[model samples]
Target chain A: MIDHLPYGVFRTPGREPRCAARFGDHLIDLYAAESAGAVEAGGTLRARSLNDLMSAGPDVWSSVRRQLLNRPPLDHLVPLSEVELLLPFEVADYVDFYSSEHHAGNVGQIFRPGQPPLLPNWKQLPIGYHGRAGTVVVSGTPVVRPGGLLGAGVVGPSQRLDIEAEIGFVVGIDSTLGRPVPIEEFHRAVFGVVVVNDWSARDIQAFEYQPLGPFLGKSFATSVSAWVTPLEALASAWTPAPPQDPPVVPHLNDDPHHGLDLRLTVTWNGVEVSHPPFASMYWTPAQQLAHMTSNGATLRTGDLFASGTVSGPQRGEVGSFLELTWGGTEPVELGAESRTFLLDGDTVVISATAPGADGGTIRLGEVSGTVLPAVI
Target chain B: MIDHLPYGVFRTPGREPRCAARFGDHLIDLYAAESAGAVEAGGTLRARSLNDLMSAGPDVWSSVRRQLLNRPPLDHLVPLSEVELLLPFEVADYVDFYSSEHHAGNVGQIFRPGQPPLLPNWKQLPIGYHGRAGTVVVSGTPVVRPGGLLGAGVVGPSQRLDIEAEIGFVVGIDSTLGRPVPIEEFHRAVFGVVVVNDWSARDIQAFEYQPLGPFLGKSFATSVSAWVTPLEALASAWTPAPPQDPPVVPHLNDDPHHGLDLRLTVTWNGVEVSHPPFASMYWTPAQQLAHMTSNGATLRTGDLFASGTVSGPQRGEVGSFLELTWGGTEPVELGAESRTFLLDGDTVVISATAPGADGGTIRLGEVSGTVLPAVI
Candidate 1:
């Protein structure tokens, strides 16, 4: 926990939300620390959201981190259980990228039978799309099963509710409009990482995603972890990315060792279902960032881009139930029960950890959600 | 202009940005009026953007309008040329909907030959997707031509730069996370409308849009009019939307007369090229709202959803150059020049008008932008 000082927004009873940093079993009140002259962030620590702190740039970020690491403010420490966690940052623009070759191939095989497993542009670029940012909630937020058109004239609650276990990168700095961010500037442009669970309604998505992309099927809810692990904390987690067969554009070229070696675990009803390897991702976060801004889309503070669904080659390593169950043909066992799609009250938890600089495990915050019955 | 007192944000040479209202050739300082006790909007009028005022709900909105109408604040009126207009609202989540049947059909014929123009679920629901909210700028902002991958390993400035003349609805009040906004609550959910120019890179879009949707092709920039015409101002503009071939789901069914009878004119380099009839749109704004939130997706205060492109039946009524020129095969005359796609110096202006309640023409603010060379 000392090495992984993730930031979050928390509020005590009857108090306004403020920024904090997680310690062993307590939280450091950043605003109080700043007020006491124990740290400096130019009044950004007093903000209700992390946007201002993030926008203060890397110099301020490192200075505050060093100060907190050197001189611990023991008086401002509050018990974790005494405060309520809120969404860490205000999301500017949310993008979900299908960067995992295994996940994309499985979805392609299931969605379009007899067609190629991968699209023509899959290897050439990192494919992604914008998502609803307002619905990005913190962990523990109950996800009500969304109601949508399952088929033509058939309106009902989603029968194929599913979850996508992925990792998201948070942008902390603003980029010039119409200027592409190069791959080498990933660390300067991005602040931290968060575990994400992009809830999906497969039935509705299949019926509507054609000329356009997914809308209601995905717009309903997207849950993210409250804690944001700074990129500097993952210094020892750098691993080589998977090789690309067809060479990419020159603008997307970069050192291949930019991938983070985080291991993600997905648990269904407290039963560990899968362990997804982040090292197996074909597209690195740097490449994704470069490709995202290749067309000169401006990056704003609090912009979030997820590494789609993390999946490996094996059946047990898949990130989504649609692939795990082979599109509902098979059911995975959950405790004593076997199920296909999510049932009401079904809970899913996704947690991850990376190699620490001190040769220990550094935990990225966990994101968990429970499916509530639809408000039909 | 009295009936259409649209709200905007403006700043003098050295003053801070504040809220204002558009008059004939002058701007009414809303903050000054509120301070003088001539108008009431709480303190939202003093804010830098229109989000607070819009979030104050319909009651406050109508009350302020009544006070401003009943008594004109003659002293605070500033000439329009003396101030610089800013983006009216801070966009929350932007959703672009394909509501024009003619635009969809033309795109289908050009992109997917031999297939049916309309997809299977086209008539059953309004197709929409989330777009980049941060890139949405105010009118008169220069658009730099974006560079993207045209083919495998081929990267260059976009050759098929095009414009989509659209009308966007701005959400005022927010809805609950798990609760859907019904069709009847459209008036309560929406505040006003703005003219939009959704810039596009057709060549990049054709290559990249596969399983997901348009990403870099359309995320570069989306320009909107500075002034926001309140829904109350379009009292007599209500017209019947085009009949749906297959009846929609009950959730999407709404008043057929909810469509606005707007007349949009498109100018390219000062040449009037098209007159798109907004009344002929297949799906109304009410239907778009109902479908967008049917899945329990929450709406935020600054959420913007636009009518994709307001193309009608005739060739001269199309909204995009891709459709009007048949995918760059037929060029359109612009003054003494001809073009299939936008040139570096080409300027596009999209303005619209609706029938006023007092039997006169009410002008919706115009959105105009000029194309600048790509920053290579």
Candidate 2:
């Protein structure tokens, strides 16, 4: 786990899907990775990128992630200086889970007051909502806010567009149909983790989020750091979760040591606000994986399963401005900055890193994006 | 609309992702679907055929989908001969939704018994799960039945893969960030619809479905009709839904006529067992669109959002064999067929057609596949 390689795609500018990762200064060609037996068992990186081979499901992927993590510095392989990171592999589906109990209760109290725990099924299984994959973009990319009708009637235009900084897990080596991945086996199947900022628009959401939930407020554009930090590398940081208030349904839960020791924090314009730890969640990622598979749906590589807004109980600890502002009521004060939601000039940074035993953070970089005027 | 040109990416022999669909005669070269116009649209149809585009969403393609639908003659787009069909777009993300109240209530009653109705959220949004987009084979493709362990532990190896014939929608534009898609604008952003047979293995599901939903049992394989009918062509047949039981939330719903008027039905072997209609849905597609957007999630073209299994209350009128078998306690009776679930070598067909004034069906053709034994 010593070598630092940056994963990305290259296309001679405009060409078919080509896989490459960054070494100290150049792209570590995945095509060569396949050919050299350094990646896939069968040479030729054809299914698209490392992701295609990943969707073949865990065992195969685990082996690769493990091998790559322990490989020594390939001083002669390549350098990062010669590469340009294209928009990472197109994400087919994004399923973000509300596994953060701290967030659930914190958000619940604000909205339901007395009911700050969770739904009966919340602790029992991984409750997830499928999100837009189209908006997922590579880092260093600017976010363009979209303009949509606000309120029921089309009167004027959209005003509030905010940002949500969080972390996401990418699935590699997907499971075959009907074969539910055992919680323990789930670990072996993971490809990597990346920092994801689920940018939002609180104003558009306020008017329309009742009967359905969230629409137009989210789908416009999303940004993600391109590097995929394999789960194997983050393994040393694994931690168990605190006991839940009520026992989960027997079918959906597992052992307590299921939580990953990942540190997630959010910053708006470089100001730290939400610093909730991943262990604060009642449900674990394994449990979430188990719950998601309960319905016979297949999980694939390039599948973006996010840990929904990691908010805490504190006001500034809110995951998104919508929660911090309490549905546009409370204005969040940031040093000299004050706002109920995100202003166009604001930049949100979502960084996820696992603190190694040496006390150094193994950061997966960060996904930062600035809001531009709405694209009409 | 005019010339009916159905597209796909397929060869005459290979069955990997290159198999072709069968149209009137000569295969419409997938290479040809690579339009000069699509390149201008900032998208390409470089798929080996429609197989990749149909399944490889996120890069929703400009092949002949819109051109075929807008042509008018509806029949002149056929190539020479009567036995050739190329490939369809590779569909990357396959999502199936449970939009039917009748189906939900009926399925729920099995576990809850006298439960009054389905969940309130069901009526509000289009709840969905991600499916295996990688295995979306072209029409006339053979399907391998998945086998798995039963509940508790392994009783023995069993062959109980079942079939769930569903109607699915394809997205045209994809969103990022947590942007919510507006309900009223859902159609404009949709590419088309295809009849899908969401294959399932209930037996394996029972054993493996716990913390998570079904994984291996259902991830095996799926079948879809060869040709895709564009969304615009179906607009004329669109119809309003019946009165709501628990009125919908404002933002989540739309005009009464938003639901499509497709006459969807499923057949096992040669027997017509279900006679349900699309209008029987408790929630409209608009609500599903709105709910999906509520979380500020974006959608992309080639992204499939399916209406989960549709079923009515009657004994034999259920959409899926799962309900008819009642957790495998009852055997479903078809004309000459009596079955609990699917069997190896068994064939299942899902056919959908819009009802014309003369009552004939404006068909999107059917998706039929035969189950083969698992390789082991």
Candidate 3:
């Protein structure tokens, strides 16, 4: 069993947003727990969000985790189903990285056709771009279908809607303006991980994403899990990342066993579709962080960066609908339902689990979102 | 002379950041002004930033402007040179729109070689993407040179540092989630405009920008002018946007005279190099805003969206170094200093002026940034 106390924001009806610690199906109200002397922290756990807690740094994080673990079960422990979960932290900046070589190759082959599978600079850098932070909603929030101009010269609701199953890292500490965080110090910067469902409009993306990149096509809504799995909880999940073929820069180089061996599963309407392995990723979290700050771009508290479309080499390991259905040419069969691309009311659930120290499964929570009809 | 009060954040020596408004050579301290009954607003005028005031909406904005104009000059008025200006508001989201047809054509010709000047979807939608808001600094902030992996296998400081002269719109009111803000309602959403210097790294951009977009290349430091010219202040500057060849969709089509006729100038190392005209932009701000929210992305207060490289048809009207230098083949002559890209200690200044009522020039302020030596 996963012995982790992932932090999240929850609230009962008529009550304001409150911070809580999740353990199984119960939520320990940190505000009430702190008031009862169960956990002593200088920061405001009473705040509606986790931004203040995240900005408290690693020492405070460790202390809070220890305090929560040591405390006895309090009366404040409420069943998870009773409370509504909100976005854990206010997003400052959201960046999505194409970290998996398998995913990149598949996308390149399907989209470009005659072009090289991977770009010439793909092996050297963890390629990433800033994503719309305003559109980042918590898991369980219904995603409305985005309407925009598409490749076929048609302008209306998206025809080829898709979802990318990925893992997200949350930044805790704010970095200095011009300082670049070294790859070895990534753990100090990033506090926790969460599952993310990067919603996309493939047809709109193909048309608009030429020289600049993805815009409204992928900016409609990006769903992230409410429960943030602390970095301390994933100690046993660490594994060796895929070896770099052309080798990366010194700044991006990390230890061999730097990747997380999480098994990410993508389900469409409760039916399992893809199983993208996190260990098969070409670039590690450290490399992504290092690359992000390498440009003198400061990292703010509540900043999030996700591994884009974590796909493996196997046929069932594709992370996105674009990859699994081969750009909507191949249809996926799910019992009575068939799908090439996400239709109206399509629900996508991405769950993840990692290896625990006791050789048991460690649940990293899940992020799921249902699609609403387009407002065309 | 033009009578306008542009808001900004400034500091004097060891003091905290204070809200101020510029008129001629003086910056009126809004905090002190409110205290002295010069301006009355329900919100905190004593705020170190203008975000609170901005979120107050157009009514508060108009009141503040009227009060400042009606009152006589007080002791709170400090010379602009005495106080150091800072970023006016906390940017929630930063979007850069490729609204200039001339700049787009130049870039397409240089980058794609034989391809058409404009892409198929270029005229259909106002192309834009989310940019790194964390790196957005105020005008005077010194930009540290960025270092990242390049295509030539060299991993160090960027070799081709450049700047893009553009106009930026600052959103004040928060729009509802999953709702589209109409083209006609753009003014109600966007409060003011600013001069923007989009600092870029050509080498890094060329290598990394692909299916994702500009990341490290453009995320280093995007500078904005300290003073923000309110939409109400630029009434006379309104002119017709260039007629769309194929015509736009219903949602994008607005009044013919929707574009602001702002004459923008870019100076490199104290020498004027470009004179990009905002009137020559293909898409209007209304269209950009409408297209942005058409995908259901909510607009938050302090959200900034900039016109990407406001270039005209003239030779000297190119906004970016990539165009002015013709991809470094035709170096721009700056008197004794001829250059293709920015060098160490190079200062870039972008200033603009718009036609005011009563046949006067309305100063739109300026955004300037100096490049520091690379930390390789």
Candidate 4:
């Protein structure tokens, strides 16, 4: 897709939803290519989300990516199997984080076996929480299977049912409440990248994650990626992250190329399983937006955040099914049966890619789902 | 004032913010009392926030509270010092909870000193999380003093800055994402009450709350309360709650009159100190909205939640200065100025009240703020 044009919110049969972009499988219609002038952007592409062209910030997002690569609207295409998409922005505060030190040492050695797998402020920073931006959603929706309690006075539904994978970002411009969005203003305060999922419920997050964290075992839904992708289509997907031996705090210092190298994969039910690299993420999406606004926390324009699972230290690189089934006491297999968590119809699907500025690759927008059985 | 009419979002002078209502000191302008036909609500109070009159729910919130107690628009008054208010709704996902068993046994005995101060799922349920809905704000706003990493390779500011006097609620009907909102549908899904604060930091939430919980030690600034109040102005403030020794389960049981009573009053700068009560809350805002939608999480219309630190077992009934300075090893005087946290231009406020089917009280709108220092 000519280095992934991304952006989303579609529609078709009886119009309305607007935005668009994509390209190869066709979609364009950025308000019908700016009403046929073939794209200029001032009228924020007749919005229906993408937070009005991501709050029209990074110089009108690089002048609408150089007028959609110099006018390639082809009379506002459409096809992508007759539209639909949606949820392409309107999250406004989600957070997530846990920046994967091998998925926090495989969820702290499968939930603290002998304690100390990572938590000492996990190499000093990016820990993060706050989710449930009204149960996120859009990316083949479905999901369900939640129900809670699960321990002393146990409740039901959710017999495990996991899947994390993450990545998210989004949050275009808007800051100051007591400012703090620094680390070189993360591409002038981010504006793209998606593929999330995050659904969990591991026994209602192991009996309600102690001391206040994962609520309702991960607020019931999550999913995401109905396109987006933008950070100028991953400018050759940065890279460097994975180092910080003991260095983090100067307001979460940064720039070791500020990682991105994507790669992910996941897929269950269709089998592929895990690949999860994102350049082995050890805290980077500009140090989780400079430690989520260091403490003056105020970002807004459809806020989001994510990047919490994306594992990577080998053995098929884990991005969760409780570290690819180890916490389900190891399961895996799949193609001919054999799983662990997540079952009622199970689908999954994550996806990713990156390295693009022409040397080809670029994908991102995937995030499927499926489950659907609880509502009990 | 005739049972606190509440609802806010003002403006005036050059005008724009819209929606209003208060009354005692004046400010009716609900779209100029729906253009002088003096209130019907179909156009949802000429909007500017209270989320289209809280998604026009609860039977148009009891037919606009019986057409504003039989049309008392008084020609859309206005005075409340010529308007301004703002931030009345548009939050959509905040949460918070930890249903005060004396503020989670005084924050689990000042952060687990010898462990177990209550946390066996804190007597079974109602603990919560998800905050930072774009740093909440709007009750006098200021706040600041945030800064982070306060430990290992330490960062600065926030020596202990705290506060938390709780009780929020809001939401307003919108649920079904795999259902669950049970506990007798908490008045058809809430729709009122405010007065929060919730700002904290305690050395950046004790060196970044161990394993994922309080981010940026309570996402810099959470104020709330430019009014709202109306759960039919707490019809004689409910009462019963505080008993569950160990029952709770069945979708969080519910209805020991479902608490409320209210009271509150913290203050600080003009020193009152603490009162806290809220009928000694022990989980009940209909069991924290049935344990926050018992995992089927959905509810939208500006979703809020809150009710965490409403401590109360004795002495000054704490709602945090980390348990009236117990964590900073006791201080609290204020007039002869002793204190123990939150300094820079200090301020605070909080306020509350309740019991009023007519027999007096009502209130709830307070929530002030101030603090402001660290942008470092």
Best of the candidates, DockQ: 1
Give residue B228's error in model 2 in angstroms. Answer: 3.0
> lDDT (0-100) at residue B19 of candidate 4?
83
For model 2, residues A236-321, the per-residue Cα lDDT tens digits are 67776778655555545576556766677778888886765665666677776665554334676677777777765566555777
CAPRI class assigned to model 4: acceptable
Model number with the top lDDT: 1
Q: Is candidate 3 or candidate 4 better by TM-score?
A: 3
Tell how far residue B14 is off in model 3, in angstroms: 4.4
Ten contiguous residues minimizing lDDT sum, candidate 4 chain A: A248-257
DockQ of each: 0.89, 0.15, 0.73, 0.29
> What is model 4's C-alpha RMSD?
22.7
Which one wins by TM-score: 2 or 3? 3
Q: Write the per-residue lDDT of candidate 1 for residues A1-376, one digit (tens) a residue.
A: 7878999999988999999999978999998988988888899999999999899888888887887778877789999989999999999999999999999999989988999999999998999999999999999999999999998889999999999999999999999997889889998889899999999999999999987889999999999999999988898999989888887789888876468899999999999988889989999999999989988889999999999999999988889999999999999888789988999999999999999976899999999999999997
TM-score, ranked from best to worst: 1, 3, 2, 4
For each candidate, what is chain B's TM-score?
0.99, 0.80, 0.97, 0.36
lDDT scores for all predictions? 0.92, 0.60, 0.88, 0.83
Task: Report the C-alpha lDDT of model 3 over A1-376, residue by residue, as the tens digit.
Answer: 2368899999899999999889788988988877777777774587889988899999889888877777644667899989999999999999999999999999999978998999877887888988999999999999999888875346888899999999999999899887788888788899999999999998888888877899888888999999999999898999988778776778877875379999999999889999999999999999899989988889999999999889999869989989999988889898887779988888899999998778887888799999999887
- lDDT by residue for model 4 over A1-376, one digit each (tens)? 7657888888878878998888887778888778777788888888788797788799998888877886677787878998789898888888888888888887888888897788777888778888888889888989889878788986789788888888988888788888787898888889888989888888887777777777888888898889988888888889788678887667678755468888988888788888888888888888788788877788979898888888888858888888878889988898888878887888989888888875888777888989878877
| Minimal lDDT window, size 10, model 2 chain A | A148-157
| Regions of model 3 farther than 4 Å from truth | A72-75, B72-75
Which residue pairs of candidate 1 clash? none
| lDDT for each residue of candidate 4 in B139-249, tens digit (9 for 90 to 100) | 897888988778888888878888889989888868888788888988878889898988888888877776767778888888888988888878888978867877777
Give the TM-scores of the predictions, in the order they appear. Answer: 0.99, 0.69, 0.97, 0.36
Q: State fnat for each of the candidate structures.
A: 0.86, 0.14, 0.72, 0.82
- Listed per model in order, the count of residue pairs whose N, CA or C atoms clash below 3 Å is 0, 110, 0, 0
The per-prediction i-RMS, to one decimal, reads 0.7, 7.6, 1.3, 9.5
